[model samples]
Target: MEAVVSLDARGQILLPKEVREKAGLRPGDKLAVITHVHGEEVAYIMLIPARKLAESLRQFLGPLLRELLGPEESEGQGGAGPG
Candidate 1:
């Protein structure tokens, strides 16, 4: 879905009702602003739900973290605990 939302003087854009409803955005929902840069300029920006973005990041980093920490650390113990 595409929408052409205008930015206010405060640099805030109001999401269209249809767009917001389609995306399941709620009044107090947190959105993560993502920018896509092409060359030296920003091509566009995307707003994703913070919860969804976190889940995606966790899924993406899980394997990398496991590799960095190794088998002993991946088993939920026996490594340097949180600081």
Candidate 2:
């Protein structure tokens, strides 16, 4: 989807109604804004629902943590290893 929205005087831009509805956003829902910077300038911006971001992080990190900690340690035998 492509959209061009103008930033209001308050430094806020309103998402198009179609965009909001398609993203399943509700009035009070939270969004996580992600940005990519290139050579001191922001090149791109993205948004993901906060809950979705947390779920994605958990899915990705849980297995990696389990592997790093080893099976026995992953079962709650200890805390994080040396950095």
Candidate 3:
């Protein structure tokens, strides 16, 4: 999907409705912009939701913590490992 938007005087660009809908972005939602370098070629832009990223991190780190600290550790530590 491609979208073209103009930056306002305040240096804010409004995302197109279609692009926002496709990306599941909504008003007041947080976005993380990622830029990639490719040997001086065209850079890549990635937009990710902050909440989604946090959720993904939690999901991935849960089992890793369990493996390192044992499954019972979470229970013994007052469920602080992942909640």
Error of 1 at 50 (Å): 1.0
Clashing pairs in 2: none
In angstroms, the error of model 3 at 82 is 11
Candidate lDDT (C-alpha), each: 0.83, 0.83, 0.79
Over 46-67, each residue of candidate 3 has an lDDT whose tens digit, in order, gives 7789999888877787777777
lDDT assessment of candidate 3:
0.79
TM-score of 3: 0.68
Cα RMSD, each candidate: 4.9, 5.5, 3.6
lDDT of 2 by residue, 1-83 (tens): 46899989999989999999888999989999999999999998998999999888877876787789886686584433445
Quick one: best TM-score, which candidate? 2
lDDT of 1 by residue, 1-83 (tens): 48788899999999999988999999999999999999999998989999999888777876777789886676584333344
TM-score, one value per model: 0.75, 0.78, 0.68
- Find the 10 residues in a row with the least total lDDT in model 2: 74-83
Off by over 4 Å in 1: 75-83
